[model samples]
Target: MNARPLPSLNILTGTEVQERLIQARALQAAFKKEWKRLVETIAKTETPFQSIGTHEYAEELAVREVEQETKAIEGKAQRLEEITNGSIASLKKDRQRVGFMRSKSSVLTVGSNLSKDAGLMASLGVWADDFEALWSVQKARAASEALQEQLDKTKEKFKQVGKKYREIKFKNQLLSANIKLVENQCKELEKYRAHETRCKSKTERLEKSKALL
Candidate 1:
C-alpha cells in the first residue's frame, strides 16, 4: 500500500484549543438550561394572563415565540457538539485500523515472495489496498470534522457576543427612557408651581384692591 501523507494539524494552540472546546461545551449546556428556564418562565407568564383577552394572549404568544427560538438555537448547538464528538470517535477508530493494517501488511510481505507466489502476493496487495483506502477515507473524515468543529465554535462565539450586545443595548434604552420620563415629570411639576404662584399673587392683589375701594 502506498502510504498517503497526513495533513499537518498545527492550527490548535496546545491547551488553549482544549480550553476553548471546554468553554464551548459549557456554553452549549448553559444555553440548553437557559432555554428550559425561558420555557418555564413563558409558561408561568401565560398562566396568569390566560383569562385576559387578546392583548395578554399576544404577550404570551410573544414569550412563547422567544422560547421556541431559544430552544431551536440550543438544539442546533447541541447537534454541532454531537457531530464533533462523533468525528473524534470515528478518527480514533480509523487510526487504530490503520495501525492494524500496517502490522498485517508487514507480516504478510515478509513471508510472501512475489516471484514464486504472484497470486498470493496479489491477494495481499489487494488487502493492503483496501486498508489503505479505508485509512484514507478516515483521514479525510477527520479533516472534515476538524474544519466543521472550528466553524461551529466560531458561530457559537458570535452568538454569545450578539446576545451580550443586545442585553446591554436593551438596558441602556430602558435607562434612557426612565431618565426621560423623570425629566418630563420635573418639567410638569415646575409648570404647576409657577401657575400656583401666579394665582396666589393675583388673589392677593384683588384683596388689596377691594380693601382700598
Candidate 2:
C-alpha cells in the first residue's frame, strides 16, 4: 500500500503569526458570545418553569431546548479549542523558523567576515613583501633622513590597518553577543507561552467537565 502524504507546513513570520493569532481570537470571541447567549436563554426559560412546576409538556420542551443549546455550546467550545491549539502550533513553528533564520544569518555574516579578513591578510602579505625589499635597500643608508621618513610612513599604514581589523573584530563580537541575548529572550518567551497554553487547556477541560455535570 502507498503511504499517505504528509501535509505541507508553511513557516510564518512574526507579523503573520500575530495576524493569525488575532483572527483566531476574534473567532473565539464570536463563539463565546454565541455560547453565552444560548446559556442565558436556557437559564431564563428553565427558571420560570421551575417556579410554577405545573406545565409538564412545557417543562419537557424546555429541557429539550436546553439540551440542544448545550450541544451547540459544546460544539462552539470544541471549535474554540481547535483554534487555540492551531494558533499555538503555528506560533511554535514560527519561533523555530525565526531561530533557524537567525542562525543562518550569523553563519553567513561570519563567513563574509572571514572572506574579507582573508583578502585583507593577502594584501598585507604583499605589503610586507614590498616593505622587506624597501627595507633591505634602505638599511644600508639608515643614516639618510629620506629612508627614515619612508619607514615611518610604512609603519603608520600597517598600524592603521591593524586598528581597523581590531575595530571589525570588536563589532563582530558585539553582534554575536546580541544574537545570543535575543535567542535567550525568545526561549524564555516560548516557555512562558507554553505554560500559558497548558493552563488554558486545563481550564477548558475543567469547564467542559462542569458543563457535562
Candidate 3:
C-alpha cells in the first residue's frame, strides 16, 4: 500500500509576525476612534429631539453600535493572539528538536571514539616503540596526577582551617567586648558603694549627737 505524503507546514518569519501585530494594532486603534466619533456625532449627553428611526435613544443606539464593533475586533484580536502564540510555540519546538539532534550526534561521536581508544588504553605501555621512553612518560603523568590531587586536598584543608579561624576570631572579639562592658559596670558599682558608706557614717554621727542632747 502507498501512503500519501504529508502536507508542508507554513511558518511565519519574524517580519510576518511583526506585520500582523502592526495590522492588529491598527484595527484596534481604528475601533477606538470609530467608537469615539460615533459617540460625538450620533450620541449626545442630553436627550435628543429624534431617536434616529429607532425606539432606543441616541445614546443607546451609539452604545449598541459600539458593542457590535467591539465584538468584531475582539474576534480579530483573539485570532491574532492565537497566531502569535502558535508561531512562538512552533519556534520553541524547532529549537528543542535541533538541540536534541546535536546532543544525539555528540553521544554517537563519543561512543565511536571510545570504542577506537579502548584498545590503545589497554596497551598504553606498548604504544611507543621505545619502552623506556614510554615508561618514563607514564611515570611523569602519574606523578603529575598525584601532585594535582595533593594540591586539591591541601586547598580544601586550608579552606576549612581559614573558616574555623574566622569563627574563633569573631568569638574572641565578642568576649573582649563583654569583658570591657563588665569592667565599666564594676567601676560604677565601686563609686556607688563609696558614696553609700559616707552617707551612712554621717547619719550615724548625727543620730548620736541628737540622742545626747
Candidate 4:
C-alpha cells in the first residue's frame, strides 16, 4: 500500500504547530527591531561625539553597546529556533505513532475477517480443504502485515528527517536576514566613525586658531 502523505499528517495536529512557528517568526522580528534600535542609538550618539570626552571612550561605549545587543539577539534567536524545531519533532512523532496504530488496526481487521470466513467454511462441511487454504491465507496475510508495518516505520523516520530539514530552512532564513542587517549596521557604524573623525579635526583646528588670536 502507498504511504499516506506526510503533509496531510501535519493536519492531524493543526494550529499548535502553526502557533509555535508564528512565535518563532515574532522572535526573529524582535531581533531585527533590536538591531535597528542599536543602530539608531549609535547614529544619535554619533551626532554628539564632539563634546563626549575622549574619542577612545566614545568608541568603546559604542562597541560595548553593539556587542551587548548582538549577543541578546543571538541568544533569543537561538532559543526561538530550538522551540520551533522541538514542536516540529513532536508533531512528527505523533504522526508516526498514529501510523503505527493504524497498521495494527489493519492487521486486526484482516485477522478478524479471515477467522470469520474460516468458521463459515467449516460449518459448510468443507473443513479439510478450507483449513488448508485458510491457514495459508492467514500466513500470507500476517507476513504482508508485518512488511507493511516495517514500511510504515521507515516512512515515519523519513518524515521526521524532513521536518527537521524544514526547521533548518527557517533558521537559515532568519540568519540571512540578520546578516544583512548586520552588514548595514557596519556601514552605518563606519559612517559614524568617519563623521566623528571630521568633528575632532574641526575642533582641534578651531582651538589652534583661537590660541593664535
RMSD of each candidate relative to the true structure? 27.0, 41.6, 43.1, 29.7
Number of the top-ranking candidate, with lDDT as the measure: 1
Higher-lDDT candidate of 3 and 4: 4
Which pairs of residues collide in model 3? none
Each candidate's TM vs. the true structure?
0.40, 0.33, 0.37, 0.36
Tens digit per residue, CA lDDT, model 1, 103-185: 76656645546543664565576566556655655665566666556545545543553464455445545655654554555
CA lDDT scores, all candidates in order: 0.53, 0.50, 0.49, 0.50
Candidate 3 versus the native: TM-score? 0.37
Please estimate how well model 2 matches the true structure, expressed as its whole-model Cα lDDT: 0.50
Q: Which pairs clash inside model 2?
A: none
lDDT of 3 by residue, 1-213 (tens): 222333343434445545554655555455445444543443352322133332224334434544454455456555555555554555455556556655655565454767657644534423332344434445545555554554455445434533543554455456556545545545555565566677677777877888899
How much is the lDDT of residue 182 in candidate 4?
52
Could you give candidate 4's per-residue lDDT for residues 1-213 as a string of tens digits?
222222212121234434544565677666556544544443464222122232224444544544454455456555545555554555455556556655655565455777767655544443344445445545545555554554455445434533544554466577667555555555555565566677677777877888899
Best TM-score among the predictions, by candidate number:
1
- Residue pairs with clashing backbones, model 1: none
Model 4 pairs whose backbones collide? none
CA lDDT of 84 in candidate 3?
51
RMSD of 1: 27.0
